[model samples]
Target: MCVYLLRGIAFSKDDSIPKTGKAAIENKLLAEAVLESIIGKKGVSPGARLSLAERLSQLMKENKVEKDATKTDNQDEANDVSLGDKLAKEN
Candidate 1:
């Protein structure tokens, strides 16, 4: 699953975004390193290792798409009502 996802990212046609290409390469290398580390481990089962790889890949993809923290904080602030304001409104 991770392999297929990585392949899709790596082979994506749109090279207009440099960051996306860099992320794909970074993820691929990280995945390779992790797989190598787990290849001969005695304690972890194969299924567990594969699950970890899949989750890691998913997380990497999600991280790439995540919004900026400052933007999210601004949105939160816009949506939030102060406790004092809420109390005054209730009265």
Candidate 2:
């Protein structure tokens, strides 16, 4: 039964990630580096690693865009309520 169960699962020829240390981590996307760190010490299928990296990259991009939008909105709000602008308008 155990043999049958193991046979049912597909394994990759090279499930491990290559490269390590700061050199391997540097000059790469944050998501890739982070996953590489995990796969270096632990085991992860190549397909699953790729999928996780894709999702993590997407989330990071979305978070950056959201932060930029919020910053611009806050600046606009500050300008709208500025004391100088209000006093100038009244004068």
Candidate 3:
């Protein structure tokens, strides 16, 4: 079921859609939502669902790491500007 959905998504990826950046992120979110829903449905064992949940958690963690890295880079740039201002004021 997941494979079929993935294949459909892959086939749908064409010139009509943006393939990188925000579009890519949106696609990933959609895929994750679909998988989560499937795993959350009836008939799946708790252990198997737990494994899927762990994978989802890891995925979210990776995304947070990327966002944190970007935020850190921005903060560094801001700090550099502030530091330069301090030095100028001391001069």
- By TM-score, the best candidate is 3
Lowest lDDT 10-residue stretch of candidate 2: 1-10
Question: Which structure among the candidates has the greatest lDDT?
Answer: 1
Compose the digit string of candidate 2's lDDT tens values, residues 5-46: 111222234644333323332434774555455443363545
Write model 1 residue lDDT over 20-72, tens digit each, in one string. 43443347677666555544365234654565567678898787777443355
Residue 84 deviation, candidate 2, in Å?
24
Q: Among all windows of ten consecutive residues in candidate 1, which has the lowest summed lDDT?
A: 1-10
* Candidate 3 runs further than 4 Å off: 1-38, 72-91
Candidate 3, residue 28: the lDDT equals: 67
lDDT of 2 at 23: 33
Which pairs, if any, clash in model 1? none
State candidate 1's TM-score: 0.28
TM-scores of all candidate predictions against the true structure: 0.28, 0.34, 0.35
Measured with C-alpha atoms, the lDDT of residue 52 in candidate 3 is: 47
lDDT of 1: 0.53
lDDT of 3: 0.51
Report the Cα lDDT for residue 51, model 3. Answer: 49
